[model samples]
Target: MGVIYLVRHGQAPMHAYSTDPVPADAPGLTDLGVEQARRTGLELARQVPAFTAAVSGGLARQVATCAGVLAAFGEVHDGPLPEHVVDPGWDEYLIPALPGGPTPDMYRSPAAYQQVLDAALLRWTAGAADSDETYAEYQERTSAAVDRAVELAGSGQTVLAVSSAGTITALIARLWGVPAQAWPTLARAMVNASYTKLLVGRRGITVVSMNEHAHLSAADVGLATFR
Candidate 1:
């Protein structure tokens, strides 16, 4: 038996949808986002003192989150941490190509932006993807990543896998037998720095927990973000 923890990266400095050109690659974490990751690490270390290894997507947010979690682990536990692996396959699904996308800083209501995103997500998951990376491709790569993580846990070792909300929810949705139409909802609701724990053994990928974010308290004004 082994455990694989999936962590959604902290809130990015800028969101791809909100930012113009949306940045071709990874973006750094904001100050508050960094605190969120640190809290996650501290809380997580309390839950699992010893992790066999840590892994993350190649994105900057994911990489930073992995480091935060490990650093917090070291703070709570007195031992050397395991190696960290970077896998690009675990990255989030690309946004669909829009014929006339909104300009950067166009400034619109959140509702309007969500409307566009919802429509795009529906098409993407339906195989009518408007971009180079289809929803199916996203699922395929994420599933492969999780499968490899489980196989490589090396007999009961615990592993931490940090990635974007889309990738984390896609894997959990598969394990929980969720339909495609409702999958994006899960991703949208996930808080930055939250995690889902999966137990791997004969049963194979059982969900011990999902969307755990107790580290972010209600008193904190701007901590529980789902961007």
Candidate 2:
């Protein structure tokens, strides 16, 4: 038997300008985001002795969170941590790609971008967003990530993966056999840096915890946003 920990990345920069697309390879975390990751790492260290492997999405925030977690585990060598892997499929649900129009530089304003993002998130969660990836495709990708984590955990190992709240919530919805349209209600309660534990064995994968945040103080939990 093995355990897999699905961890959502910590708080991120909520600047109104955040709607601007970051270079695919260079997204960075904000100061508060770093603190969130550090606190999450401390919590994980208290709960689990060591992870057999740590994985994350290719996103900068995911990798940054992994770094914080490794440092907390006292494995801060100057090189790569052991068994770190990245998969694009583990990335957050893509915001609907904007079509040909004014470049980002020509957008209405920061506040306007934030409003658009808020509405888009709502439509996405409500299953009303016409996405490049169909709803079925979205579910399949998330399921594959969970299945891959289970497969990688072979035996007597614990795997930890850092991703986004949306990714984690999508997986949870599948695990609970909930309808996709219910994701908004499902995701609304998720806390950043919180983790859910799943046990995989011969019978099947079992959910041990969902959105566990016992390691964090109340102040360190919940969403942080810039309005």
Q: Which is the leading candidate under TM-score? A: 1
- Candidate 2 structure, TM-score to reference: 0.77
In order, candidate lDDTs are 0.78, 0.68
Pull out the clashing pairs in model 1.
none
lDDT of 1 by residue, 117-186 (tens): 6666776677774577667777888888888889866577999999988888888788778988788788
List runs of model 1 lying over 4 Å from the truth: 15-27, 96-109, 220-222
TM-score of each: 0.88, 0.77
Superposed by TM-score, candidate 2 places the C-alpha of residue 194 at a distance from the truth, in angstroms, of 1.0
> Per-residue error at 127 for model 1, in Å?
1.3
List, residue by residue over 106-174, the lDDT tens digit for candidate 2: 234645654565456555555553566655676788778878888887788889888887788888777
Give, for candidate 2, the lowest lDDT window spanning 10 residues: 98-107
